[model samples]
Target: MNHMLLTVRQDANLTDNLVGVNAMEVLINALIKSGAQRSSLRAKAFGGARMVDGLSDIGEANAQFTLDFLESEGITCDGHSFGGTNARNIRFWPATGRVLQRMSTDRLIEPKTIVQAPPEGNDLELF
Candidate 1:
């Protein structure tokens, strides 16, 4: 079977708009609808970097959200590289659930220490 690759981008702000399509709910649903199974699916999560200076903890929130969502769905996240100042490029093979995470240093940005925000209402937007 051909492997499927999913890439989720980074959102600097934890907003309601960031949910929905970007949430793991949608990802898993899409995979299942396409005949992917949780037991057979392995996830490679990436790209939660604090890119902008003096910003809040959006990157960390995104990483946590991903973990929580996966855990809730009983999906195994076999690989992950998150919560860093540098951006990362990742590739995931859905067939075997193998993931490759690579960090980028060519265009690195300095991260600023910021406080995390409180979890608000249901930010997950299901499709």
Candidate 2:
């Protein structure tokens, strides 16, 4: 029962680096190298809040991309909270596949959201 969390935040590097398409590969490889069985691997992604106005909504793009990547790899997406005007806090238990989320924009002043990913299925809950 091993789990992995990929926080897909908008990065300045994503615009020019392989991160735009290879980020998921990196995460999967890291887990494999860490002795995690591919069959037992699962993903719960977070982050990618539209934290700013007048800028591209990279957060949403990153979050959706992450979920799409997981689906393509046949990994179960237990939970996620992506693309919102509010920033979020995600707490995940990799050993148990349990996740908690809270979205708040009142305390912060930025807005962001993430990508164009085709979704295969949906089971994530937003908070």
Candidate 3:
């Protein structure tokens, strides 16, 4: 059986706007050619996060771009998860139209460490 799944990652608008209208139109056209109606198009966007530190965060921009494109094309995005510092693992079953997502933050955080108010004083202490 043939199924369709998409993984979109756009770091920058190099090579004359691959992440913009051109790419979206191509995808849309392909779907239409494959017998999908433009009015019935729907999307689920994922995987846009700040995967690194000390660099420009373009993940949010990419995510926003996709949403904007879908909106402009009259497509419905009923599901999405975007813009964070966590790594995500997504599983989609196209035949059943089911999706699963698991997110893990890259930071090392210990739940046992709890913050307590310090002595009720103006002198602040840095950890």
> In terms of TM-score, how similar is model 3 to the real structure?
0.68
lDDT by residue (8-126, candidate 2, tens digit) is 77653446235655766777788899988899887777888767666787786677677777787889877776776677777877778788887774544544556677656786756
Q: Give the whole-model CA lDDT for all candidates, comma-separated.
A: 0.64, 0.73, 0.69
Comparing 2 and 3 by lDDT, which wins? Answer: 2
Worst 10 residues of 3 by lDDT: 1-10
Q: Evaluate model 1: give its lDDT.
A: 0.64
User: How much lDDT does candidate 2 score?
Assistant: 0.73
Instruction: Kindly report which residue stretches of model 3 are placed more than 4 angstroms away from their true locations once superposed.
Output: 1-10, 14-18, 105-127
Per-prediction TM-score:
0.64, 0.68, 0.68
Candidate 3 lDDT over residue span 6-46, tens digit each: 44463745543454678778877897798877777777778
By TM-score, how accurate is candidate 2?
0.68
> What does candidate 1's lDDT look like per residue over 4-86, in tens digits?
34343566345643563365567667777888665766666676777766767577766777777667756676667777777
Q: The CA-based lDDT of model 3 is what?
A: 0.69
